[model samples]
Target chain A: MSDFTIAQRERENVQVLELKGYLDAHTAPKLEEAFQSLLNAQRYNIIINCRDLSYISSAGLGVFMAYIEDVRKNKGDIKLSNMSAKVYNVFDLLGFPLLYEITKDEQEAFNKFAGSAR
Target chain B: MKDDVELLSTFADQATVAIENSRLIKKSIERERLVQEMTLAQEMQRKLLPQGLPAVRGVDIDAISTPAFEVGGDYYDFVELSETTIGVIVGDVSGKGIPAAFYMSEVKGIFQSLSALYASPRDFMVRANAVLSASIDKHSFVSLLYGILDVRTGRFQIARAGHCPLLHVGRSDSAYLRPDGMGLGLAEDDFFSDTIEEHTLQLAPGDACVFYTDGVTEAHRNSDEFGYERLRAAAGLADGKSAARMKEDILRAVDAFIENESPHDDMTLVVVKWLGLTA
Candidate 1:
């Protein structure tokens, strides 16, 4: 599958991974690479819009789980928005909603980011 | 003059031994390097296989997966969706080494996502087939057995994308369970949806289904493949064991049968036992 694409815009030092397609064993590596590159550059404030994501497997979920702590340690948070029902089911099953700040849309997520930063 | 000749001969013999020793040392170093490369390759291959079954209840599963040479294409894993439904996949990518290993990962991902949306094995194959054909290298394609096992019903809905025959064993006999379909990632117009077939069997107690890549059937002892007949015989005999034990036993038999012979491809095996309600 075409890996979820990542487009970046600097919002005072935040990087977002806009994920699409299926995030399973195959495409997880691409996400992992993107996260690695972001972390290497010390960009921690992360927002992942899973609007177009159709599915996510354990391996794909693992990438976020593995990096979330690092992002938080840098005084940054990882937020998710616009997750399709199928993808949300996977995250919900894994109890990820408990660990991360998930929002319904970009406005709410961006508001949370602004509120947290202050 | 006699003493001088004796000394000369002794020196010449020592020189010959010294030259041989140097050659041996060089050969030993080269051999060690080869072993090192082989081990690295094997490690890479091992990483491709899933470490363990997902923590999903209501499923009895076992696998015997071994990579040929350094890295081969065989892979198997269970993707846990919930306590009752588990998505299982076993496949072999076309080549060996890094390319096969990488593609195997891609296959795993494709199958996982397809599985998330589509419960029907045939539909899953159709979507994954289209995706893989578009993304992977044009020359690479994979033979796969993707299935969803209903733990509550003991029914396995399986779709084959040009894979080896899966066997259903019961009553001291075995039957082939394979979908007539093409491989994934091969053609632009390759119709996985139409070609995919689904077969359902209510796995009664003591009934087992054996899923494997072609490595088992194509295993060579001298020249011939261990083939489907021998595999059926092995499954029939494995009737009494648990799913995990049966998988081990079958792999052991296939391996022993092809003793002193090397398998030309990656070997993967998955055994599911329908342990119906206990008394």
Candidate 2:
């Protein structure tokens, strides 16, 4: 069984994906599939709630880089939220904030989507 | 006597079966040739690393790159930039085996050629990222830290491309130096250049400056990560030690943490100690 899992839910227009467990090279394809399904449905306003994310690796970040262009091209943006310090450290070190908006919590990210839509 | 005769009859039958299957012999030969080719590739990859560290005027330097059994890509190189300055770099490509090894060679060529042309660490990184972003796949990237040190003044200018931060251990205090920079190939040229940060520091005598890849902090025992705190403690143990001893200290710390676990990725470390300029 894979240690990583994604729970999908919708709150209005924003598609929230709650990521749990470890995200690494071994489980990156699972994340790729999640992003593919989201893109296929034409649902672009995305909020990735990383409250339960324990670890992340370069490959996991690659999955994000691979999909962000496509997601943005469709006029939908992916915002990240609720990352633990350890998980956030990985993003901070790699300068991920420049490409994706990271929020302190899920509500903050949801509010960002609302703000943009207005 | 009957058992011996039966055994001889079985051997004769096996010999006949072997003789009938020429394809089996040919397959075995192909497998043997493949093994030989893989060994040659491994040797060639090993030879790509620096034969030895080049001696600089007023600093002590040591480095070690240990490839895991599966050949994860970890590379380090040194270039003398001027009469008093030396350029050093450490990089790790994503993924493992043949593809990673090949990408490493590409990175090596790009860095070696570009480092001489651009003296500024920030400019070197921007050019490297521009080349890499236009060429490599979206999912593949290299994390690199390139630094140029002037031995005469003990001044170092460094830029990081999503690699581990530099570790500086003084006589009584030690910390990881964090500079703002993205990994190579992850973003376009203008965005990458705008986002990247470079820092300069003056190395004091008896200070040990360490540059390393993720393999050190990510090394684990079961599910427990070795982490940066442990890495800091390990390198701090070498505050006044030689560069070689400092390298050994960090590697030994990781080894003792992981025990006999076969590594998942290659580990690399390059240590530099400022000895002050000689009259």
Candidate 3:
């Protein structure tokens, strides 16, 4: 069986989530919990760093959809950064780009939020 | 001493019988729980599908879905966009059973709520993708084919998302229609918008369009898949038949192809036949 883990940190009022291992059916709930906790805390400015992430299935993609509206409604946004081409392909394949702001690195994603704030 | 040994042996036999009985009870309880879960899931799955096909002018439409498990991932629906236009959709969620059924219901809700707001198939898909990309589970995805048919003009506009190719049958020949697009919930940015494209077809008299899920092509008998070729052939043979008849014949052919072998996935077929103005 594949494994998955999520670690969190705070930077410049943005909540960053770092994901590792496989994001598939068995491990999707962990990501969901992480998102839920962030929402509960009213921390809506989220940046998911997928640099260490290995794989994702459609269910994994759903985690983002589940919370995006609430986050945006609260005047915060969820952005994604640092995805391997392989992980990125999965997102790209399903038409995620039109609805998300994906950057090449964490700094850029953070910069996007900061730039918008200014 | 012999009497004492006989009494000890009897006691040991009784203890072993009691242990066996407890084990059997535990197994029975576990089996019952699983059956109850499956029954609930099946009921939920049935409710997600459209109760009946709607009546649309200038077109004959029919659909069928069969699940290999107690619950399935396949779904189809029709929404009347207006008095003159109707929207049709067919999709398959990845995986099967309870989880798939849950996602299927979500997709159904998204379609039902959003189809009325967007008139263009491409626009509707783009919006649906936006919503689905945000909410769907991370481990699963849904492949979909959505189209809007103009009843008066016999014009069909379609958009696809990693679903199986649409089969088009004219008066004498049939062909597969491949439109470029990815499945829902796979991407979240511009790549998805850039990759997704739409196609339009003018259906004349005696023309038909078939929308299906991968289960139709991936249906297997041992090592051989039912395959696109076989499906195309079946569609060709179904030429001139009513939408309902064609759907039945194609499913019959698939049943024959598999013979006694059980289906490995859910099978769904939706056919739209253009009868033209004369009809």
Candidate of highest TM-score: 2
Off by over 4 Å in 2: B1-44, B237-239
TM-score, one value per model: 0.59, 0.86, 0.69
For model 2, how does the per-residue alpha-carbon lDDT over A1-118 read when each residue is reduced to its tens digit? 2499999999999999999988877798998999999999999999999999988877788889889999899888999999988888888878888789999999999998899899
Tens digits of per-residue lDDT, candidate 2, B1-279, equal 999999999999999998878778898999999888777767877888898997987889999988876667788999998888899999888766577678889999998899999989999999999887777888788889988998888889999988899998888888889798988888888889987888998888767789988888888787787889999998874446899998888888899899968765688899988888764
Report backbone clashes per prediction.
2, 0, 27
Report the interface RMSD that candidate 3 achieves against the true structure, in angstroms.
4.3
Q: Whole-model Cα lDDT per candidate?
A: 0.73, 0.86, 0.83
In candidate 3, what are the lDDT values of residues B41-74, reduced to their tens digit? Answer: 9888887888998887778999988877547788
RMSD versus native structure for model 1: 17.4
> What is the lDDT for B137 in model 3?
64
- Which candidate tops DockQ? 2
| Docking quality tier of model 3 | incorrect
Ranking by TM-score: 2, 3, 1
Per-residue CA lDDT of model 1 for B1-279, tens digit only, reads 999999999999999999999999999999999888867767866876778766545556788787665567787877876667777788877645667777887877776666788878788878888888787764456777877877777777887776766788775667987666666664454444556677666766667788888678767675456877888877764356778887767787787888856665668888877665532
